[model samples]
Target: MSTPVLGNNKRASCGPGNGIRQNSLLLFLLLALASCTLVAAQQPPYDVYPEAKPPYYRVRYEASGKPGELIFPVNYTVWIPPQCETLRGVIVHQHGCGEGSCKSGLTGAFDLHWQALAQKHDCALVGPSYEQPQSADCQMWCDPRNGSDASFRQALTDLGQQSGHPELSSVPWALWGHSGGGHWAGGMVMLHPNRVAAAWLRSGVPLFEANPDRKSIQPHELPEAALKVPIMCNPGTKEGVTVKDGRFAGVWPANQTFFAEVRGKGGLVGVAVDPLTAHECGNQRYLAILWLDACLQARLPETNGHALREMSLEDSWLAVIDGKTATAAKDFDGEPLSAGWLPGERIAKAWMQYVNDTNITDDTPPSAPKEVRVVDGELTWAADADLESGLARFIIERDGEFLANVPEKSQNPFGRPLFQNLQYSDTPVQPLTQMRFAIPDGDDPQSHRYRVFAENTAGLKSKPAEVAP
Candidate 1:
């Protein structure tokens, strides 16, 4: 389904007539805000969901414009962690342009893996859907200087009041965006650098230089303030010139220009090229989450509300390409590299493994399910959580025969499968702890044997726990 695009009504007259119309529009917006406040006060806070599905909190805010003009509306959905009492920051996962990606925004907040990251940092996960049609000008909202930025700030205030957390307006932001959404995220950092903790721009960035041919996109100015924010530019390898006529060919040039300008200005920036498919997000989150985790730990304040501690460069390592092979560089000496300044040794190793194979290399499996018992065809067990990749799902086998998988959910359009125990879809898989699988009734009860195996997001399966009936 496509989001309806509302058109603005223009006045034929200029001069005094235009002035009068502008003033009327401002008055109308004020009235609208007041009305929204009244309605919000009467509405109850949205409940947090363990699985992906509807019933999430969403608020629509109109961009500022002349009265009677149909301003673009930005629809925002926020997922607050059920356990977090005080939020430290907020992570905004923005989708690309077009109908499919815009619709994907509905599920971004429901992602369980992102929720885990947010929960660890006491942050809220939010997604914004700009109601721009497929053929519409993406610059209308992607450029933060436009009214979308104002609408986003307003939405935060509205949600803060609705959720009874007024501090939401003051907390820092960790932005993660794809395609045109990347342009939005990157633009946001440039516009409001101090308020942002970090940014991950995937396959898109706002152009600092204006192209006379493309006037639709207003060029953004690179401000000195943005130099402090940590940013990462991730583009697919296939999007480069090597592909010649690839569909996403523009991605590499944009990333190169952006990275050069930002890094040349002494900004904290890095580039991590996806070795796999072009334009498709494949196994990037495995590194994205870890990178964000390190950035947040180094940037966020302690419990007493002190200044953030600086990240030590000495602890970081660089990964560079030597001929056809990938090599780790302990020293950073202004050399051309693939991944520059990995946070730590573990992350450095993970980055190397990822770049070399286009997947996270994790041989260690999750802890096996414990106390597995079957009573009256009902199975119950508990498994130790895998701290590395996080638990994806549990494999159940009956007498060495494949049985049902717990919490069946569909995979997201992104690379992650639903069975991976991550939120790729709007509906999340039910928690494994609360899951109960019914055994087949026709099976021989005495001769039946059940085995349970825990799988991590890396696709590693743990040792099985066997139970005899």
Candidate 2:
């Protein structure tokens, strides 16, 4: 028997048998309906993302039926390092508005590069995807005051129950947001100052004064407590700096207003301009991670359920509004309070490298790949990413001699080479970077002892990891 089903706006025609009984036809129709596939109910775009296995947890929420709640369904994915008895904080990688940007959040927790940062601080990493359509008003969710704040906290509680890490709900959050996501993170800093360790706003920022052009944007007041959280505003130079008069021309101006308002009020905020591209997130995550790492190191509460540590201003670094690089506070001759505020020396150097060009150089090598094993004709291993300079590729050796490079060549078009080519979402391109090497068939397998070396984007190589022969 043939059945007709309508899906994806297409309909199929079914042929009828002559003189068929109406009751039998109805029964046949029911059977056909039961087996037919409906495209209308198809899984969402986010479903294509990688699965959340152990050490990683995921939760989904439908819009609450109550009034004034999130009008769209939301998904939250979290990753926790294995063997951690307790967690210190949660680092959120928030995406911008629109379906394409929001869908990118699906793979956020699975990004190996980001996972390295979370693991180092014993903090959980969270990616939240709100199923917002292209036409929806962004302010509804981007402004956390619009019910997302409550929903996010609820998800944390729910995730804590699911992952057995109850501390997830109590720990402070280090936020990294792009575009509309930046609005949410900045607003959170304004709303719950004590709960935020730091915030990095890329390409978008919440306004301190309501703008006549954007009447819907509710302004947030800077409370005294909010002034202490380390904040960085990153916007592409083309947005307004270098190439003005484009779609993103207002981005830099908005960022400036946000920075000025925050910094003028004793707020620990600074601006880092992306000198390369505009609108699109280009090489911003690299700097964002570096800044957040420093913040987490200096600010994560010493004990769980405690207030965030205040950053010391003595060791601070200052950079003039248009300076290429920052100077240590001690050496700077400018008015301390007027310049951009960088947390400390390490971040100051990194910030300088990032603002001048997205080419951040690393002096150290990545950690060596470990647990190397060969199965059948393939070799596999594990490695930790170089937080300073991300992993680029792996060098394979046979009997201490060069065999081949895993990814024969680098493919990153954005900036420096990276192992898993970086996507705009700050995630490694899908089908995660293969740490596997195929043993050449022509060569005698038994005669070869394999070793792999981790390579960073700076072209520095790590000590080789050998496999048992």
Candidate 3:
């Protein structure tokens, strides 16, 4: 993984002594407690609007019954586009097991890339964080048959009332989950197939074969209804096939078993193996977003509040092609299968690129900024938007060292901004032609070499344009 350029904590030049460290720790604890108290006083219990800058709301729900039991509270967050008049569908991004992955769910709704797709399709982006601890068994929530499913449904209703988008309770869903969250997503599709438009399972799936030895996790049944929902199983190459005894060894096998059973029964399922790291989500979103975009286009109704359009086999390409060197259906040797399902031409090509390199190679970057200038502590530039992926954000550097990013305040909890239009005014908050940033407090603008690099939605960084010191 690439080291994060910004936000790395730099230790103080003069290290504090043990006594000072202890006092500082105590002060920090007291401040944290006071902050928590202030926040709780401002809002009702179980409700928290995360520090994300986006116009979204989050609510927490405590697990019912005992305190020391397996059950834990679920944190649900949803982002509705400011321009949306009437909702059409919803996209749910679920995280994996463990405290880290679950907490990572806090950023799902704020993801600009995911939000872009949802915005285009008039769908709301929602994320559910099941606060299962590190030591707890994932099955308690990963399996939709458990209390997690009920929590998810209830969250939708509660968030609907809170966000004033009550229609969210009834919209069809496009589900994406990573690791154990993948198990939950797949389980939800199987349990409520009619309500799902599509599902993307990344590196995890519910086991269909009965394991008498591990009876705690009951095997899930594959009903005919589930066959209607389009599903994709994406596992990393190193998980099982390449590294036999790795920690994620079971990932590929679970995906294979589920794919075989579902496809064998004429279920709409496909597998995309990530050629990169095992378990870690790397460039998977590029293809995942495109695939869901295609599915939502086919399944969602153009008019709001109407029933979802029935998916048709004829609308999807059905060809069996190797992920590498298979762009078009004609690229394959055999004829397109009658029962097989595939995405549109663009998405299919992207899937091929994704599986081959585990990265989407977009050579084109956003147009370079013109009329670049620095005044006092502020730097300003003008540039046009990238026609393909659209402009994501800008990177600023001083003397080739990472300085800051444009739109300094994080657009989402992940500390990245979508920068797309927020209000119904149908225009971006800051015009692409105009961007400004304040120099760091310690940096001397007169002597430093400042440069700006534009990043697109595909996460590609552009050639830097230097500003005269």
Candidate 4:
């Protein structure tokens, strides 16, 4: 497998020790490696991906094995919100390089957190899983110019037709990618910036200047038109920020170069450091969703086939490059082109919270469950997720009295508790959260009624939806 750029390989430099010579140095290096390994192990292993159920359609392509073409088979899964007459765009949740990340892509469309953003804007969610083995060359697929670009476009065409939403092929896109996937997403933005509304690259970016060392890697040129699309570079603090050694430590430098090159040119690019992680995604989806949502609001066209609206920077917010706090761009004391540009004030605050730690909060409660009814032996309902905070769990009420919570124990191995169980890739885990609760036994069929209430991660609860008689 083509490993990502290890900007720095000295484990001691990125970890606990600065200068230790002798047995202590060996111990420090060993501990540093162990620490990185431990953090990565916290995420679930890539075993097998789940099946694509209803409302979720999938298309697959085989490797052509021809020159300059995708050499691996790939599966593209798409989820279109129900009752949608048309689609505004598609959100691409591209996973990083490696078997685990590739498999995680299969569940990207199933993510309720991301789905909330798409559903709110009437867009489709797409997850593409490239069937590359652990020992294969990741560059074969991570680099969009390496044939995956053609495959990506083709998938949209097929998905648009398969989902009966032919507009998907022509709609704009909001991209969120991890690691090598980040590289791919950023590349797409550079190549097709007009169609891309925005992009969030977590620990990856495309090369602005060509590297003579990499014959297989071709550099992308910065186009004036591409500056219209907003982009963000996210890298872990350990990746050459706080720590300067270890695997993936190069992520920070790569992101830095990308940010400087783009931001220096007055491009709408920003950076957010993941203070609590190395390469693993630790609660980044919260901030990413917020940014993309704002971009969609400002960029999406008013009508189905109209051109995207232009976003002016006259009243935008700005923060010091890689700084935690943000304020009005006009008041920014630093150089205007060098400062990080935020969509607005709301996102600026959220970005600060995320940079310190992924502790973003939501004040308002989620909407109450709708169309509550008893089906067979379970009480089912429909609900939308809170834009600020995602759905945590449901309160099963027996005649207005609290009975139980769907996930009795609310937990988020990656970050804030979520009903869908957020994974490392910002996607939901297998066996996605259900909106149905089993009917408690011992209640007479005609005598007992049920009400379901929605709750967000912030502990706010919504009004109850009573089950129909």
- Model 3 misses residue 159 by how many Å? 0.9
Which sequence of candidate numbers ranks them by lDDT, best first?
2, 4, 3, 1
TM-score of each: 0.73, 0.87, 0.71, 0.87
Q: What CA RMSD would candidate 2 show?
A: 12.0
lDDT of 1 at 192: 89
Candidate number with the higher lDDT (2 or 3): 2
Per-residue accuracy of model 3 over 343-400 as CA lDDT, tens digit each? 6666666777777785565667666766678877789886555544556678898789
Q: Write the per-residue lDDT of candidate 2 for residues 1-469, one digit (tens) a residue.
A: 0111111111121111111001111121011111111112224333355567778787776655455576666778898989678999999988777656666676678777788899999999998877665545566677888778887888788889888999899999999887778888999999999999999987778777664544445778889999999999887788778866645667776777777888888889988888887756677777888888888999987789778899988888999865687999899897777789998888888888888887776788989999998888888998888887778899999888998997888676656667877555465555556789888887766777888999987789999899854
lDDT of 4 by residue, 299-375 (tens): 99988778778777876888876678888997888788888888888888999999988888778898998988877
Against the reference, the lDDT scores of all candidates come to 0.62, 0.75, 0.64, 0.75
Worst 10 residues of 1 by lDDT: 14-23
In model 3, how large is the Cα lDDT of residue 450? 88
Q: Candidate 4 at residue 143, lDDT?
A: 79
Candidate 1 per-residue lDDT over residues 243-316, each given as its tens digit: 63435666677777777788677667777777775665666777787788888888887652444455666666
Worst lDDT run of 10 residues, candidate 4, spans 13-22
Instruction: State the displacement of the C-alpha of residue 167, model 3, in Å, after optimal TM-score superposition.
Output: 0.6
lDDT of 2: 0.75
